[model samples]
Target: MALPRTAPSSWMQSLDLPSQLFETGSTDYELYEEDDEFVLSVELPGFDPEEITASWDDGVLDIAAEHDDQQRGERRTYHRRFRFPKSVADEEITAEYTNGILEVRLPVEEAVVSGREIEIES
Candidate 1:
């Protein structure tokens, strides 16, 4: 008789070894409203500004960074699991990195106004 096979636990399935061993962990992020735009700040240490990439699509904002192979030598192993939320936008977004921090500015779209005015019947 063969023993039954069991599914892996949620925690076990979410682990990414490559990211944990070599890749740095995901940076902390903060979002705030600024005037007519939303500002997002992410704390990324030991990361180059040119190595980061960010984009938004289908209500999800994707952020990814890969260390330079030539500059940093061979890719190191990682053991981390990170899941970033996607942005819900049809157009592409832009990001900037500076002082070990990444700042993203998103412009708020103006709300549409309906032309129909309700009249009171006395």
Candidate 2:
């Protein structure tokens, strides 16, 4: 007999609300996975590499930046909020910015696996 399929969890359904409320920036990102590390690339336009800041607290990565003087003037204005998950701890991540892009490298922790089998007696 085939097992029954279950519906998606409530947490998955809740995500749709926030996505409708906030629009992501024009920037894009790519994640690369290697044997030992994960590399994250974020594209940031109209920002100087020196002005960008990135931090990882708990398990969420935070990236923010201000436009350079050449791009900012009295007529310019912006209002937006970007919320990150709480899993990213501040001490577990490092980042760098270059060429109007921010790159974050996160090292994956090794998992410990035990090779053992147990039989349950009814």
- Where in model 2 is the C-alpha error above 4 Å? 1-27, 68-92, 114-122
16 in model 1: Cα distance from truth in Å? 18
Q: What's the TM-score of every candidate structure?
A: 0.56, 0.52
- TM-score, candidate number 2: 0.52
Residue ranges of candidate 1 with Cα displaced over 4 Å: 1-27, 68-94
Clashes of 2: 10
What's the C-alpha lDDT at position 12 in model 2?
43
lDDT value, candidate 1, whole model: 0.59
lDDT of 1 by residue, 1-122 (tens): 75436543333445655443343444477887666566778777667766677766554556666665677585522122223343322343457888978887776665578699899999
Identify the candidate with maximal TM-score. Answer: 1
